[model samples]
Target chain A: MAVNDAGAKQVATYWEGMVNSGLADTKAYGTTDFYNGLGSGKYVTYLAAGWGPGYLASVAKTTSGKWRAAPLPQWTAGGNVQGDWGGSSFAVTDQAKNPEVATKVAMDIYGAKNTDAWKIGIDEAYLFPTATPVLESDAFLKKKYDFFGGQTVNDIFVPAYKTISPFSWSPFNSYNFNQLTTGINGAIEKKTSWTAALDTAQANISQYATQQGFKVQ
Target chain B: MTQVETRSATAPAVAGPAPRFKRGREAATGWLFVLPFVILLVAFLLLPMAYAFKLSLYRSTLIEGEHFALFENYTQAFKDPLVRQGVVRVVLFGLVQTPVMIGIALLAALLIDHATSRFSRFFRLAAFVPYAVPVVIGTLMWGFLYSQDTGPLSSILHVDFLSSNVVLASLGNVVTWQWAGYNMIVLYAALQGLPREVYESARIDGAGPSQIAWRIKTPMISSAIILATLFTILGTLQFFTEPLILQPLNPGSITQHYTPNVYAFNQAFSFQQYNYSAAISFLLGAVVFVGSYIFLFATRKRSAL
Candidate 1:
């Protein structure tokens, strides 16, 4: 039932590790199902099924006290690359009173030296800092704790930051994605044909694009 | 001759002199009293509308080096399918959701007004609590509640109410839930304003509560109902945030062009189709204006008879 390939690999690793460690009785679920199960306290502990700074933070702060964070178990043979789940960027508004000063201050706050602080803040605040230098700092890099069985999350996250793809966010992205997601979910719930849902969604999005004057294929 | 003499005797009294400078001063005082409001109206309301109209006619993408294209945006919007869908969706939404919402509000108002229990005040406040919550927060709360995984309703119903096919209905539910209380308060106020004597006379004639409500109460407060209907219609036409936030739960349920306002927003911000966005906005405004006029005319006709 797992939809994501990377996520399935992660789950397989966790299950295999559990079986080897004589924890075969334990059951595992996808990240989506796991979070849903959290409210009911059905699982002993939940390991995040995917890589992401945001997911890392959530896994680190388990209310059940049984949950912990760890480096995602590898997928490929000798696979070392990590991936991000979600992140956001900051921009200086054109209307800002002092764009240069504002940019400088923003850089300092989000930049490398502040990595540990940002990580700590993110741990506490759930706000991910995107600056690389700060992400690689000792404060972020050397962190070790009982959380995630004492694994250093920064070791994985800081390295993954470099490999992260730069994503462009359009204002239309929120609108377009929303419509698409809603349509998909509706199809799933109603037990309607997926093709029909997709066609409807495509038509809706295309119509939207055309209205917004975007050339659609 | 006698009549003429009498008229002459009263001529000075009949020829009352104009109050001249004092009346002019009183007129000046009246204008002075209204000047602050007039200034504020012009500065805030009138100016922005005029500016929006001007902006709507010209294309000014926030991007630098962009030149103005007059009426080109409007023409392009007319050609956009998304804009057309948004308009169609909103019109349909207004047609479907507004009446249902107002009807529920009216029923609730009547129920609370006629409730024989002492807890009517509590009922009124409980119903109105949704309005007190900010719309964004309220919608978000509903979003979570409609969520397949986390929402309590979904868990209880064992169904994903926020799924794509039914999400519009779900959005309608949230809108109805949030505003029903607000509209109820207005209708209830109108109901209370009805002359007590009419109800008393109805009761003396052995007329039941329903009879009184149907024959007397509703007719007396029809104006309030019409006003609420108009407000709901206008509000539904400008639907945005509910669908926008709800979009996250069901991706394809609402598209960028699901509503006219969202369409205009995406054009301006995403595609940089500023002229098209402007044109769409003016078109939406015009739709609302014409729709309101039609609604007002229909209600006036209904009330006239």
Candidate 2:
């Protein structure tokens, strides 16, 4: 929770209210467990990755047509909100016998020229190619699923990805996650205030990053 | 000439010495017999340890290729808060879990050792079966049993067994159940090795079964108990599998840095910080070595008695 920034501070206040209202510790649930919980109506909303809906559908078959993808809520009215989760990038390593050929092959997989076809080849369940042309094409944008009541899911996500706040990862992201969760656990257990937890996490992460020879801010 | 001939006749005859070439060939054959094990150990264990140590001395990253940082990674590992906390948490876990586990094991070993019935063998096998189960499988089974939804524990106790507050105890229970039998087998073997005459003498001296167990058998087998304790301590400090498998079921309680080894593992694989991970691992190894030494030293006099 942010203490200095007014925008973040406001969101933090709202988050505190949610916690006070008995926001169950979501970390206790694994992917499958959470999916089961969702299907059982144990949770109202779940903030998830771009691929979350398709995954939910496969796991929670009985919950078809019940759930919908919506843009995340904003701290202030008319403000935009978006976040990114896990993803991998393709690269041609130095060990490649022909780097140019490797680069070309990598490019073709997600390139604008052939990405749409590749998505089709993968049966479209493996969704969300990051190629601009593929994303804007009718095939991708107009795709609908029975899971979300036949809504075009990308219509909600595409615009959301555009206004997402720019974020960078530190080399110590794993260590950062570990400390962050520990602080979160403390807050969830009611052993400490969320603000204190965040402060501690920030101090610990900065120290950790510095020790790892990173240019910590 | 007569005296010399008599001395030569009196001297014992000796067989010719083994051929030098044959001895050399025999030595080579012996080495050949052990060659497979030696190669495997060096390839798997020794080589990896050497490489890990070398990696620990360098800092590798996407931006800077790889550069030797000397002891920089080790220093960073020493300073890392997560490493410190994880080590401390495991030490606490070891302190509590090791004693209880060993106590249960000693009791079981004593009971089985003294039993005259045919069921003793069955009971011994039953006690040891949990240890035979793979750690991941055992932990997962325990995870299911601890589940609030499907497990009977929550309904019976009206409390969440896998919740943040009680998850550690739940994990401890799993470890104790799995390993107490293992330590019991070791202690039980030692009990079997004890001379029967001591117990017979104790019986003649009006010593009851319980008395003989505590005053005679227990003290004689103190060394085996210490060995069990040492292993338990090391195992506890290096605790990873149970928590890791259970993490998915209860992440809030068991974070990535739940134990030192887990922290090191996450760092190396998840974060791709192999150098730092190696450093953390060596630090943990150092702790384990020193801890074991101190324990053995502390118990030296008692075991001597």
Candidate 3:
């Protein structure tokens, strides 16, 4: 099951592996939908990503099986490249009452010393913490799990955190990004040249930036 | 008898030549009645416009502060290619989207008015439901539907509707979807207001529905159609929300200056070029006013014929 296909391969590989392992009879007890199957009690162990962790945790609790949390699977074992599937941040408004206290609490929860606690809290709250210290700490790093064939999940996060960069947000970021992506995706779906679409997008973005008085490089 | 009549007139006029002061009091009452509206106009509309005009005359950054530059901001705005592009995009949107929207609205109104279809109320309401939805929400929904992976339409059709080459058309589809029904309702009301006797007479004279529609109904409601077209033109010129929402899903296709309003927004907020943004806005307003006047003039000419 190649990840590149992004369709049927993972499911096909799972079923084939189950049959080879004398677990064919167990298939009837589980739904083929992987997302739904994760909730079913048929599987004793499951590997999951950082997204929707809270709902996953609840599902794990409901199933009559033991479950554990781990970092995302790398395309290759110990790969340096990592991607963020989803995450959010918290910021205090200027007009908020007790902003100083709010900032203190935020820093304490998301700051350096309590990295392990933060990770644990995020898992409990069904969120992924963005703090690098928490992601690389001993509590997260030393964990060995049987679900992913005993691969160390913490290794993936350390590399992912190092490779990650902060996203630049602007009022027009959403607007510019949408138009550019829409054009690219449209071209991709239409089986047209993706480069041409991207080129045009670049031109458009530059034109727009210049018009808005942004000194584009 | 003459003496009695003179006395009666004199008695009635005893309060007579009711003071010249009373006329002045009536004039004051008139002013009192209009005072609230006058005060509001000055406070809200006139004050803001004056402030905006003042802002346009200065080179300013929101955070860094402003300095008077006379026409420097306007000059820079005019010189900027991106501003030119924004202006062009808005003009193109108006030219393309306005007629198409109004045409569809007129067609729908005519069909609903003449067709013997059942459940017309249901259709009318369904057509108008898009107007009930907020533009931001509607655009976001359309954005999702335009998504490559999860959108129902994309999945079913197996086409990338948001692609760069086709995005302008895609945007047009969204704007038209939201506005066409609204325009239709306006035109439909106008159609309803047409005297039934005219239609009956035409029918008695053996006139076909198409002839009646083309020759009589359309001509009579030409004013409504023209009004709808003008409204659509103004709305198209100010289009911001749909493109803004769609930009996120596909950044490569849209840019900060895709439309004039967006261009101005980015100028003031993103680039901290408040003066330039102000100038552009004023210029845009002027363009809209002139364009509307031209359209109205043409409409009047047609109506006169």
lDDT of each: 0.69, 0.79, 0.69
TM-score of 3: 0.65
Best by TM-score: 2
- What are the models' TM-scores? 0.69, 0.81, 0.65
What is the DockQ of the complex in model 3? 0.08
Model 3 Cα lDDT, one tens digit per residue, B28-51: 556767899999999999998888
User: Least lDDT summed over 10 consecutive residues: which range in candidate 3 chain B?
Assistant: B4-13
iRMS per model, in Å, is 7.2, 3.5, 11.3
Question: Please, what are the lDDT tens digits per residue for candidate 2 over residues A1-217?
Answer: 2222455446545666777787843436454456558778777677767677766777778878888888888767997867788754456789999999888987877677885565783245656666777767777677787888999887887777777778877555676676766676657655457666667777876655665456754
* Chain B TM-score by candidate, in order shown: 0.86, 0.89, 0.87
TM-scores for chain A over all candidates: 0.61, 0.83, 0.54
Let me know the TM-score candidate 1 reaches against the reference structure: 0.69
Q: Which candidate leads the pack in lDDT? A: 2
Residue by residue across A1-217, what tens digits does model 3's lDDT show? 0111333235435544655576643221122223345655645554334544345556555552255444555556976544544557767789979999998997876776765667666545644556666666675566554433455554654555567677645445654654455554445435455445556666766665665456766
lDDT score for residue A181 of model 3: 52
